[model samples]
Target: MIDGLSFSLLTPPLIAFTVTLILTGWLIKNNVLKVLDHPNPRSLHTRAVRRTGGLGMMLGVAISWASIPAALPISVSLGVALLVLVSFADDIFGLPVLGRLLMHGAVAIWFSVALLSEARGWMVATIITISVVWMINLYNFMDGSDGLAGGMTLIGFTCYGLTALLAGNESFAVINFCIAAAAAAFLIFNFYPARIFMGDAGAIPLGFLAASLGMIGWTKGLWPPWLPVLVFSPFIADASVTLAKRCLSGEKFWQAHRAHYYQRMVRSGLGHRNTALLGYILMVSAGVSAMWAAHEDIAVQLGVGIVWGGIYLSMMIVSERYLERCPGD
Candidate 1:
């Protein structure tokens, strides 16, 4: 048998990955629970498929996080739990937009006040609070395509976890790593021609954690605030650009549509597997550059960002032209 301390260090990620596998298997096998996501104008999937994979992913994280007090504080876990419940309801009953956003905002407020109690200024606290809400929503928005969200979660958290470890923040590292592990396990079922979808339940809570843990890392001086931005730049760039376009065009941003860049690419004839792999390439590039920049001076960090920014710009333009030539709608 393994020694206690050593075993404990390995427990969170191991248990999360294993449980995710088991839950995914069960979810796929139990046809009664299959929340077949019917096809729509915005949907990439043509047929109904299970949408309960979020339960698998969230269950793994929830069970493992509760047991690892050293890695994830109870307050953070509570915030995740609240979002998961609200999102789960949204998945089942088609929650009203305003109500869902309000609950998300409430959770953001709780996080900002409880965690940043000694925040220097109310303005700072308010801004962080709003950012948290955006993080939660944007992630849910970006979960439209097969493999996109799971790949981002796996790559982004793995990068964050590794960087935190390098900075001597083992607690942050372990939590991040375990999340990444769970995401990886979930990806097996969520990949191209996905057997299941993550739904709002998984996307929302994961988004909140992405922001919350990034902030925690920053506060602890474990990593720079922009580090998370870099690690998740692909999703951030895609979601931010898509939101801006919708605002400029005066569209109802909350309404589901296939306007997102990743969605466009898939609808534009680039298959799901190809678009997902391209996303993976971008993710790895951003993550590797972020890790490298962590060791360099401020100027080098900016240069790294600029390089990635240019790449993102190129992708956006390419996607646009491709869609213009072969419009999906």
Candidate 2:
């Protein structure tokens, strides 16, 4: 058996897991959750369910961070806090598009300034910030179905945790493990035909954390840049391509729609569960590719992303064709 498995080492994740469970249970008991947001022409759910499950995820992270002894850098903490705040507000009050974008940009700047300070220059910082913000929004866009957001978090963090362990970064490994555990707890309630939705609150913060942690690992030389990109390849492909198509067609970029590739697949009668599982498989493939590319050349890393993008595009085209053939709604 592995030695030194003590409570202190395990405390953070336990705290997070317990907090999520308690918060979710309380929300259910108090009926504080909104159940009136019934499925419509654009929604994936067929019935009314609680739409604030993201609150539980936020609570988990908050409690986890609070329990730790300032182990994380101040800037990272601040960036995450900003994201949680904006996401929570969006979940509750529905902020305007520009407001959300501005807040996201601010958080991205903070994250870059804090974490990438030692990096070469402003150009790198700009790239990191843009990538972070894009990831945050992409994650939010993908959270429409049950288990989707939480599963993605769990998958990404699980890889991070493994990488940390291999690199002997025990503290960072623990942090990633805590995140994975928290997401897994949320997943218990977030599975197909979910009892609660994660909403923007959980998805945005989770995505931010994932992106930030990946950056931290890269900066520390524990992993390469391709790792995080590989981890989130599915969301990036789906959201980016869909957005490109919409922009090409002159649709308002900020307006919500049901044209996401996964959404289209679901509308094609694949069902949300199957579509989500398919995305999960794609994410796992990316993770596997990242692991293999850890010691390989940059070309291999870029190649993996390119191949995955091709596969994603092929699936999207097929799904779009199927959507075309379906009867009008």
lDDT of 1 by residue, 251-271 (tens): 887788888888878877888
| Candidate 1 RMSD to the correct structure | 1.9
Best by lDDT: 1
Query: Can you write out model 2's per-residue Cα lDDT over 225-289, one digit (the tens) per residue?
Result: 77888777878887898788888988887777887877767777888788778878977878877
Give every collision pair in model 1: none
Q: Lowest-scoring 10 consecutive residues by lDDT in candidate 2?
A: 1-10
TM-score of each: 0.94, 0.91
CA lDDT of each prediction against the hidden true structure: 0.84, 0.78
The residue pairs found clashing in candidate 2 are none
Candidate 1: what lDDT?
Answer: 0.84
